[model samples]
Target: MHRRHFLLGGAAVMLLPVPAVADAAPRATLYKNPQCSCCEGYADYLRRNGFAVEVKPTNDLAEISRKAGVPEDLEGCHTTFIGRYVIDGHVPIDVVRKLLAEKPAIAGITLPGMPAGSPGMVGDKTEKFVIYAVTKDGKAPSVYATV
Candidate 1:
């Protein structure tokens, strides 16, 4: 209860090692074509934003995206699965966090193609990103959010 003891205790606590939270960061598995370096950048971006991303390079990305319900023409460069949802392409971190928070009744969200200035892609952003939501029931994707 003394001032000196309180100050010392606070300083000691601050110096103690902080433990990593168990599963605090959401775990996501990202699948990309073996030759794309942008995918690695995207994975690193995700990791910096509190997502534990595991990058898996595969030649069957097209097949994986198709099986995950992403249309062939609408597939992104990389396919990431987080919990029950699939996030395709270089989607913004805020949008991904929003998708995970909202937990909508859809297969996942996608930012089709490798848009310039997307999360990991280089070049100036030419236009606003239009993210789409795809479902498992073979329905057309709808606009989820525009960022």
Candidate 2:
């Protein structure tokens, strides 16, 4: 329950109880270069999709990605930590939710570089995007999804 006040006149007021709302937003932490604006856009996109995102600006994004088990060649513009998995690039929230729901035994998933019309980046999509799942065992990434 919520408390609220209503003013009927200059000298009159009424108290009322308003219903409370429950908005459960999934949480994620994103790390990106300090000067990258596209990452911010991605964070906003996540927020719009009911995700509670905490974006951190850092200059050592490459080092962070490397430590997170993402290969250098398949790195994205930003890295996000959702639950127990790492998400690279401008991946859509639906895919992220799928990963969380399925709970795969991989390090995380990556969409590679800043693809056009992926999530935050600009421009129309020229081709279908292949999302790769990276593992901690140093094996080559395999296709996870296409969108």
Candidate 3:
């Protein structure tokens, strides 16, 4: 092939978008009660960040978490399933994207309660918090990310 043609082809290849690229977002299934405004807001946040969200509204949150293998201590207002990873509470989209991209061996990521500074729970000021990776056996979770 001519050098000019080859260079043009290479540039075109570089500009092509790959579906499996780390920046590509995975779909998530979010479970929450129908009347929960904050939970809806969180879902919107995920949608805005390119997450394909499947929202299941129900009042039986405990059952949902229990079936999903979410630990009691790591419980949050909204529970989400992104592939094999469970995302609890109002986790940041970036962090969730990172978790999916990395595909860690842990059961999931949890923000615990509805923290004032969490993505959907944004209050007066942003507070630093840690999202934990809950092990399968439900032990003390390791830190997944700090926000």
Candidate 4:
């Protein structure tokens, strides 16, 4: 009788509905100059990392970056918008994931220039790259991460 009750309990547990896992990957809109191949490569990297990327080729990337609240000194070749945060330049996938998970109250994050070893740029990491966080008020940017 005890064995039968245990088996019944096991069956009941098995029949319980499994909870749905939330999708962590966020959709991104990338704005870049039409002639920049590195921007396309960055988009490809985002796609590979489970992000749905929409590439928008534009003639005025600078204007787009400015409107998106990217600081002048920290602007990259391409700009990406994910959720409510703007990601500038060739930011790594791990950092992007962490930003989404943490949900910090910042305007966005930027990798500044096109580093040699960043996601889109091909080559070895010749030097450390600093990622800056743009404040909500579009004030001075501060170091957010280093890679």
Candidate 5:
């Protein structure tokens, strides 16, 4: 009889709903040109991946990128901030997830030019695209990943 009572208590505990984690996923704020449809597509892609994304349309993307500490040469069509890290261009979602998980000590990561077949950009991916990590001081960028 005691074993039956203990089993019933354990089942009751298991049935309780678990509370949601406050920081389950970081929110992403993306700044893009108002006329760019690809940027919107990227935002949707982020949304599908469990990230809470906020899109801000701007006419001066370059200025925003510069102010965000993205290296000039590594600038992309859109710039985003997730926590303290900047995400540039149409970087693959998997790579972004890895970046968040690793939490590297860098200003941000960039996919450089709008490569075709990237998350938002539409085209055939003829060759491998490289992602660069920009330093906090906005000097040179190093290769962070390739997709």
Candidate 6:
């Protein structure tokens, strides 16, 4: 075959779909106080879901949250940034991925406090909690996910 034809054939073969990769997901950065263990668990959850994570240890979590635009009422143990959205507390990785993929109009999602049975707060005596979607202006949050 001519060189140009052979190159074209090779390019076509390269374009053909290959087997789906087992792991191909963008990473996210997590910021939380250094003393919180639950926040570490939440980070682990993110790791299992194919997200490479950078855990930032901070003592003044409030300051960090304030700068990141996380609402006071929605404050949790952890704060994560994926693209433009800030995720707070023990929010499920799946939910984070959903928000990232959908690119909703809301500012972010929060699980609030250290609710038991949440991604980081997994235990037998779990307390039910609600996740809120906080807007940019720090307004009242609409229920995003409930558990």
Decoy 4 TM-score against native: 0.81
TM-score preference between candidates 2 and 3, better one: 2
Clashing pairs in 2: none
Score candidate 3 by lDDT.
Answer: 0.82
Residue-level lDDT tens digits of model 2 in 1-147: 123333344235334444444236678999999989999999999988888899999999999998888999999999999888999999987888889999999999999999998899999989999898998898889998998
- By summed lDDT, which 10 consecutive residues of candidate 2 come out lowest? 1-10
| TM-score for each candidate, following the candidate numbering | 0.85, 0.83, 0.76, 0.81, 0.82, 0.80
Q: Which residue pairs collide, candidate 3?
A: none
RMSD to the hidden true structure, all candidates: 4.4, 7.0, 4.8, 4.0, 3.4, 3.7
RMSD in angstroms, candidate 4?
Answer: 4.0
In candidate 1 the C-alpha lDDT for residue 146 amounts to 99
Candidate-wise lDDT, in order: 0.93, 0.89, 0.82, 0.88, 0.88, 0.80
How many clashing pairs per prediction, in order? 0, 0, 0, 0, 0, 0
- Which segments of candidate 1 are over 4 A away from where they belong? 1-22
Tens-digit lDDT string for candidate 4 (39-108): 9999999998898899999998888777777878889889999999999999999899889989998888
The reply for model 5, stretches above 4 Å from the true place, is: 1-23
Candidate 4 has an lDDT of 0.88
- For residue 46, what is the lDDT in candidate 2? 90
| Model 4, runs deviating above 4 Å | 1-25
Q: Model 4, poorest ten-residue lDDT window? A: 17-26
Ranking by TM-score: 1, 2, 5, 4, 6, 3
